[model samples]
Target chain A: MENTQPATAGRQDPTALPIGILAIAGMTVFAAVFLMAESEAAVGGLLAFAAVAVLGAGKLGLLERVRAAFRDHELTMHTAIVIGALAIAWVFREDHFALLMLTMAMLYLTACLGLNVQLGYTGILNFAGSSFLGVGCYTAAVLTQHTAIPPLVILPLGGLMATIVGSVLILPVLRTRGHYAAVVTIAFAVLFKTFLEVNDSLGGPQGLAVGEMTLFGWGFNSNIEIGDFYASFYMNYFLLALVITILAFALTRRIERSWVGLNMDAVRIDELAASCFGINLARWKITAFMLGNFMIGTAGALLGMILGFIAPTNFTFADSLILLSIVLLGGMGSVWGIALASAIIVMLPEKLQLIQEYRFLLFAALVILVLRFRPNGLLPRADRIYFPGWRPR
Target chain B: MSEAILDCKGVTRRFGGLVALDTLDLQMPRGAILGLIGPNGSGKTTFFNVLTGIYGFSDGAAAFDGRDITAYSSQEVYRAGIARTFQRSRMCLPLSVFDNIMVGNHKRLDHGLWANVFARKKLRKAFEESYEEAHELVKIFDPPLAERMFEPVAGFPMIDRRRIEICRALISHPKLLLLDEPSAGMTHEETRQLMDDILEVRDRIKDLSIIIIEHEMGVIERITDRCIVLNFGRKIAEGTYQDVANDREVQEAYLGAE
Candidate 1:
């Protein structure tokens, strides 16, 4: 038999770089227009256009071609995406509300990426994602109020605090499976809220005020004045959140593409098979749980600092469901899907006031529609490629 | 016997009041293919479970490669150079062929989180090596299948999936490979092909002992160097295939004596 290799093997598509850059530019323009739209009709029209464009791409089989191009030129595509995201801030430099919303979306994206590690990648169901975020927020709130430590220093410290608390929660979580495990997390979520509400030292139901994030004498809470050009203070928070989100996204992708991801997938699919193949089931589960909690905690800490105050109400069970919806709606285990889902989940309600009051219902309806039509998610996770420059034929 | 890779003394496994595997004494020499055959519910798989540490020994001990592995966990057993394929074909169907095989290569891969994330060049080098190893192993089974290395296993047929499962077990380069009903859900022709593939694997991978639990007498007769027959959770006969085929107890257990 002749030795046959895939035609595209080990070769970079010449069009990939240009296509990737164009895609990013297109997305950035759409985001800017969507953000600047004042009338509800304009916002709805843009949403419809996006929906139609995505559907048309799928129908024309262009989605796969775009995906292949992105995969072939990952570094280029990723850099373009980062630049495009940063350009959005530049476009809306004076729009405080847009910057604030953008920052919130990035923070939520970070938290959802963490949750994806456990729920999507590891098959560990965690319904109390907001509780871990609360752990981080509360940790930051307390540390900033009582200590002389810098808020930037307290950022990762809040993540550590959540990981420590998550370790305790995982004890019960580890003992259960499927819905039982979800129940354990749910109980923890309720318990955490009650603990915060009843504990006076932690400010009870009124919540606590968190100090501003400062790095080397630059307060993130202050507006920027660049010689006749004025930008909202939220831009500072947006930039920081963007950095954290990018790091989280990159780390999540690395984990998903490596050997650790293979082991986690093995564990997720079949514990018996994973164990027999030398994967420590408990170790992977704990690793995923702790890592996820740390990401959520850090994002929450930053969110607290961004908001300047965080009450128990901000991290309620309903809030957690919204995070879960983003993961489910985005397509489990797909980072790109999660990023898109978070953006839509965060921006949709705010953009259209008519659906803001019934946001939960809207989310439920959207999730139901997606699950019914596209169960694997809007953009399901693609196959893992071990070697660079190799695509499955 | 002294050079055996797997030696078990009084290996027993009991579930509630029923003894699934009675005090079974078994020895498999290095580089030998041992066939474990028995009627359904006669403890053939139960014995495998005990030996591989999937099920704890009720009242016995097992040693593999000169180490006491009686108390080892399944993961520890695998790390100690023992790998296995499941009876029901437990392939992570969503995973690519390379990914499935790499699951068994976990013992060889650097699993440190920081290393996987920060050490890109090192990780890439490791992945390239693994891909080559897995590709070569798959090529031994089917040259065509080797070309589709990154394709998901879900799209493969039963024989190819079985081949992939065997390749997964072989990727770790184990001292012993446990195949539980490899022929299940496969046609007779596919089984014959798989048996040839297994023989090819044993030849390519030096000194690799294999313990296969098969119901097909022809398969046991053709491939296995030695045969162990079980009846009522006890070893009824053990010897060459002809010896066990001629044993009165083995005959009685299979055909029901008048």
Candidate 2:
């Protein structure tokens, strides 16, 4: 209470809190009083334990200070959330399935954000974001499999490759307007997927097995123990997630406030109006598609590294819908909303394990309920939250 | 005066074998309101589109401010300072009102991709310029328009949406402004107000020339310095509103038909 930290975010997320603090502040405050009045030692002790547990939450505040100290400054809230989520996922490495799912969700969020650059922000509604993710996945997987190049080199190359492909897909279809352009972009994605599936050299059906990347002679396979816990591989995962998430946040925020962003928002509103303003639709659309998919590709590389596998079966049209749903459910062009939506969407199926065989039905029902109740997802941005009661930040 | 600002010399367009226009010629004087009137499908909208480069003429030449704009692309035409509103007032329903006008002023943006995305000094300057221009034009509509400019246009009603469309066109400060049925859906009072605003717009910019296609007779008669009447895609009459109103063909084609 006496000392103030440079970086502190007010939170009480039901995780990492001390028993004494929670007893004095959270649910236990009233519940603890009643238990003490009853003079039941077991209930009082339980309440005291909860209070002590909640007090440990102060560490979460301390973490913000430690993170701010270590970071190169410009570590925004968006990046903090992403890094925190990735770090937590890696911390639970014993559950490989959870790691796979969370990483995939992160990648999916990146893809949706990429498409938001096309459809949500600019009103292009590109069906090619998932294809770019697939392209990126295969690009890194194939490059790493056949050659001795580092993952970082392949990472950028994957982005460039997707950008080139994105441009090629956009150029001819530039004349198509409305849903026609969307259909054409989707057709290109299907074509790309088919091209990859038919190509024998790029691992046709068997899929590509990428060799591990070595950083300064220490391969990704090399693990160093930090006390009792294995930390080397986890550090690589966190570092990758941290860097890409930072770059994505920085790039996106810059775009949101840029002239091109202004132009994109214009194009989204009215194409004829945009043209009158002298905005070159073809030029900006291509640029946006390229920038968006470039992020998708980088995230795709991260996805591949985490999973250490890539196959055509994983990337499909259904995957695009999943990403698009995340964007729509999150409120189209909102960055934080989409990212948070991705996390919830990723965790949904596991949380729905009780429904088992009817999981898809349960998922669909849950989505309907969300759409019916809160059209915007759990946390919505100021602009998209249409209710007058909600205040803008 | 000064190449007549906009000169459509013998412009003709065809839809399959149907002759929409047969070498129609018109001269729009600089900094003046030119009204276009005709029965439905009488080539009035078609003529406006041809001039705006939204539609290509089959035969004839149109020049704007001494430039041979006959072959200019839509983008080129727009870059050349030509902006127009739609007849039905098609607005980006999802975008906020201010963004609607901001989109309209898109051509004025001077930033490239790098500058735009990075918000470098150049991008900020470009946005500032456009924002200021938009801010001024939006004031004519109302005070809330400038304040609520961030609201998306699609959710706006008939009047605000129409005004937003016009403000968007005006944001770029076009040399030649085209209004396709601007007073189409307004009440008598609204039309009167709009006509006064149009006249004010002309009075403000000495270099600004406008070609307005309108169905509202009151607006056409009150605001237009010169009026052109078409029937069956032929120039039935041209002159002052009195000159066209008294023309037998024009009267029979429009007022008589109604």
- Candidate No. with top DockQ: 1
Model 1 chain A poorest 10 in a row by lDDT: A1-10
Expressed as tens digits, the lDDT of each residue in A178-246 for candidate 1 is: 789899899989999999999999999999999889888998888999799899999999989988999
Report the C-alpha displacement of residue B2, candidate 2, in angstroms.
3.1
Docking tier of model 2: it is acceptable
DockQ, all candidates in order: 0.72, 0.33
Fnat for the candidates in order? 0.81, 0.63
TM-scores, all models, native as reference: 0.96, 0.80
lDDT of 1 by residue, B40-92 (tens): 99999888788778899899899898999999999899999999988998999
Candidate 2 structure quality by residue, lDDT tens digits, A172-239: 56788888988987788788778878888877766676555556776665455668876546455545
Model 2 chain A lDDT-worst window of ten: A384-393
DockQ of 1: 0.72
Best by TM-score: 1
